[model samples]
Target: MASEPGFLPRDGLDRLIEALRRDGREVIGPRVRDGAIVYAPIAAAADLPAGVRDAQSPGAYALHAVSPDERLFAWANGPQALKPLVFVPHELLWSSRNDGADGPQFTAAEPAARPTAVIGVRACDLAALALQDRHFLREPYPDPAYRARRDALFLVAVHCTHQADTCFCASTGDGPEAESGFDLALHEIDDGFIVAAGSDAGAAVLAGLDLAAADQARMDEARAGVEAAAAAQSRSLPSRDLRPTLLERLESPQWDAVAERCLSCGNCTAVCPTCFCNAEVNEATIDGRENGHYRQWDSCFTSGHSYLHGIVIRSETRARYRQWLTHKLAHWHDQYGRSGCVGCGRCISWCPVGIDLTAEVAALAGEGTA
Candidate 1:
């Protein structure tokens, strides 16, 4: 049987944080910085972005003080998605040193266990993590490093009560609420939090905190509030079946139009939480006496991504752009059972040209031009 849901008053959040820390878990959460909310290592509960809202745009983000401190969690997503913590940006797979007599000696660092709790994770990012799990952890050949971090961490998902102009989670059916793949889910109910456990671990946390049980009426109200926020989304993708539609429109001349303005700077892939493609390089001393190999994040926009024998599959800017879009919206489903995008809009918000992906998909679906 499922455990009963619990509620935690907003004032008790500090106690909960301290308890998690006492239990030896490193707690990280959002904090107000220069002019935006960023995920940083937090100690005191006061460091969190309490009573502040963030305004986001492509290549821009700003922080604003709220009136009356109505909803402390009323904020849009952040510029950085929580991907690097799991899929390291760079790592050394193995290193070798010369033991003068022995030809070469190699040692590899085993993946270490991480006991971490990330609070204030947005709904879109939660969905992105689920998508990444399918690619890196649930695959036949799982990534040992990613699996270690994912298994040891606890997720605290937050419902987005506010939406940005670039947000489109509704169209993708991924967010405005914590649907799945979270241990604990929280809804901002005025100054307090309507907390619910999504898994056994979440229930254990709630039990440890000894929080009060949330009544059915409060749960209903919280659900309604989440639905209203989802309905208030200002952006949406077209309703066409993205996989078939995008594959059919691969040569429809729209690729060149988008590529013309796109700098091909690879910002989209970098900000994307589910892009797991990477490349490996081996380095050695000038005399080739010692050597080591390292893995680094790679993107489809790179010229060397498709290199084979002296030929590149996508040499032109337009071809590379088309390949990226098609793979994300079309081929990804065929390869992985789910779309590569999580509707986080991180790609759109980080793009230097303000290239909105929702608009691009709508244009490709023949709804209208971006």
Candidate 2:
């Protein structure tokens, strides 16, 4: 049976947090840290960045205070996403030590994931998480650590009432309002949130919250806010299926144009939620004592990424940038059943140089259809 929708008042949010924690789940939520909103451990709703909003554009982001406001998730987004929670940036796969008489002994890092509940997830991130699942949990060799962490996750999604200029999830058919993949979804309004459950666990949590049944007036208001946020976005991809057209434009001069300003800093791929490239590293002690093997997040923009047989394939910034764009917009469809971009616009806002992919797509896509 479908769970009835309820209005979770501002005070009820605290109770909801308490309920999740009481259920033996550690809560992770958005909070202000180091001049940006970041996902961090939280004990209560008070830990959230209440009344804090953000303004985002190409290569710029700023936080502003909305005084006398009770809104906790009034901001569009921060630098961080749900990627770090499941796909750890740096993880030790295993470590080895030298034994004097015996051979080398290796100790694998045990998957020590605990039940975790994340609040204030946006629709774009939910879509990105789905892609991450597709990449990590594929057949033939699923990532054990990623699978363990993913299994213990409980998602609490929130509709984006406030969107930044860099947002374009509507164009990608991803956001403003979350529809699926979340355990509990929140439709935020001025006074509170209109909440619904997408899973049995979510229904259990909702039932314990003691929230009132959502009324027609507030429900209408919540829908309106989400619609306004979607409509307010000015950026968009040329099409949802940019596979053929982007691939056809591989030799286009637009690559040179973008490379003129591109920094080759790998920030775009680093911030991208769907780009899952990792590099394995091994360290050995000079005294032949011990060795450790680690894996860390990597990016295509790195010059070493294309290293093979003592030769670099994508040596120039232009080629590397082109590879990123084509793979993200075109090649990913073949590999992952859809374009890799979720239109979160982290690449744009977090870019050291203001290189907007929407603008780049507009430049390259001249009268071409997917």
**Candidate of highest lDDT:** 2
Candidate 1 lDDT over residue span 285-368, tens digit each: 887777888888999898899898999988888888888888887788887777777787878878888888887888888988
Report every candidate's CA lDDT.
0.81, 0.91
What is the number of residue pairs that collide in model 2? 0
* Per-residue error (Å), model 1, residue 246: 1.3
Looking at model 2, residue 194 earns an lDDT score of 92
Number of the top TM-score candidate: 2
Pairs clashing within candidate 1: 10-192
Clashes in model 2: which pairs?
none
* Candidate 2: C-alpha lDDT: 0.91
Off by over 4 Å in 1: 67-70, 283-289
TM agreement with the true structure for every prediction: 0.93, 0.97
